[model samples]
Target: MPVLVNSHPSPPLHIDMTPPKPIIAVVTGTGAQGRAVSRAFHDTGKWHVRVLTRNPAGKVAQAFQKEGMEIVKANFEDKASLVKAFEGAYAVYSNTVPPWHQSYTNKLGEYEQGVLQADAAKQCNVQLILFGTLPYVGPEFMGLGGVELYDAKARTNDYITSLGLPAVYISMPAFIDNVHSWPLVKAIDGGAKLEFVGYVVKPDKPMVFLWVERDLGPSVLAIAESFRTFGRPLAEHPLNHNVLPVGSWRGTWGQVSDEIEKQTGIPTIHNVLPSVDQRWHRELTKVFHYQNTHGLFPTDNFPTKVFSSLGVQYGTVEEFVRTKIAPMFRKS
Candidate 1:
């Protein structure tokens, strides 16, 4: 009686019992980069995500747990713990941070920790390792001595490569998130109206601002896939084996100010700091100077084809200011 004319007998069910997806261990999984990289790998549902944190009971760790990530407690200073956590992983996303509690940036400690991470990855025999390192700003460059915050990670980049491990160094552009800082944005006390938006860079120096939370993850996915498939981007690449500098929107802080003002109808300015007296201010100004003096990130070979071929869409500085930063009128 049923209308079964179009349907013959159903085929038998088949469940292929293949091995599970590869595991990617995210060391320092609670930081911003950690959250981005881990989420990128996790969202693909193609990899078994293992996030290493010092506190498994912490809120961030718990959130990772809810997302089906394997949370393994790890302390970078403790090499044995890292080794145990890193074992049996296909790849490792190594992001080492200096303990801000100790003078903002600990150069020696970060370098040592990076070596430890590299050592662990080597011991585990991982297929790939990704290090979130900054461009090496050594004392020889501009004689600003060297920004330890950047140099520490740069030192680690060299350390990772020295081991001959399969690795990709990821140099992130300046974070657009700095728009939220007190010096950058101003608003009528507790009100929604913007007063002023500002930054420290010289008005016209073109810098790359990345919406890391949204873009970094996918870029990581793209890079990892390329490395996994053909050991590098199938598309011709210009960068050396050590660093793959990913680029996004290209503009200056002055242009950024104009964009914010255009979106919010507020006055904006490049309020360059009068003096780099404060310790943090001095260090940060050096970073801006580094970008100003010797250019920041180059975009010519950003794996655009790989990104498009893989159906990846990236965010722009304008969109970021309009959607996330603009909501913040939300910024001053």
Candidate 2:
């Protein structure tokens, strides 16, 4: 049986007084992406990772304990809990989850949590922060109207910028790993047709991919190291945020289908260029329609030189899919 722990009374907090060892606290450390980020920092052997969890005895919390990560119970809604969790840390990696279905409300919670953590960091004299955000240009994609999710995050981004803190915001691209939600992963196993609605120029448009949530750890660690160097410098263009479109390639729907066939030894077909009304039954069709129709596709395939200069080498979507994602399917 696994066990969860809460090491609150331990004062003069254990800090690795050596090169490369930084004390960092990650919010919602039990979450998919959060866990990955925590693991990355721990595996580097340079930082002592503290995880924030509301219930530090659940399955996920126990898993982190096994990894030797310090588990702290921190409720996002409770400022005291947050303050307690962030005590004596050198940095805070912010990521929080609130009640689902309330897009606007949940996003507000995320923003508030960040501000609260920053306040705690200020009090503790932490050196840096690493935050995750989406690529949004304010009302740039508002013409479609149903992108409340994007809007909420954009609002949060704006708030973080106003704070004069040493922070690095990783504007992550669309999780190419989101392909799992589509029929592609299933198609990889056997007979299934890949479908897409709307006009997509074949083999020309660059499609970017992000790994599944699990593999986001090392990437987040790299970003944390970057923030340690960049410090709390205000971004020249704050509201207008961008992402590095990694694991992105220009290919058509046909090409994607062909690739699937090649990989799985199966025949893959697509409906291709259907009437707007004929698009596939996507649960988030409204969001996708709005983004695609307005040509506001979100991807991060920027030149590697920018990241290389920062000493961050992120994984490619292909590598993430083949090495990380495909394995999930095998397990299932």
Using lDDT as the measure, which candidate wins?
1
**For each candidate, C-alpha RMSD in Å?**
6.7, 9.7
Candidate with the greatest TM-score versus the true structure: 1
For candidate 2, lDDT tens digit of each residue in 186-243?
5333434333222332333444444535446665665566655554442432312333
Q: lDDT score, residue 284, model 2?
A: 37
> How many steric clashes between backbone atoms does each model show?
2, 12
Per-model TM-score, in order, reads: 0.82, 0.69
Candidate 1, residues 1-332, lDDT tens digits: the string is 77757567788899999977888999878767788888999998898989998779989899989989999998877779888998999888998776552322333367888998999898988878888888888887788899776898888888887887778888877887657543466665455444444335676877777677788889878877776667553223332245766656667777777777788776654466644436345666777778777657554444345455666687876787887667766333
Instruction: Report how far residue 106 has shifted in candidate 2, in Å.
Output: 6.1
lDDT of 2 at 184: 40
Question: Among all windows of ten consecutive residues in candidate 1, which has the lowest summed lDDT?
Answer: 232-241
| Poorly placed runs, candidate 2 (over 4 Å) | 1-20, 96-109, 137-142, 181-184, 187-205, 212-215, 227-257, 270-286, 293-303, 324-332
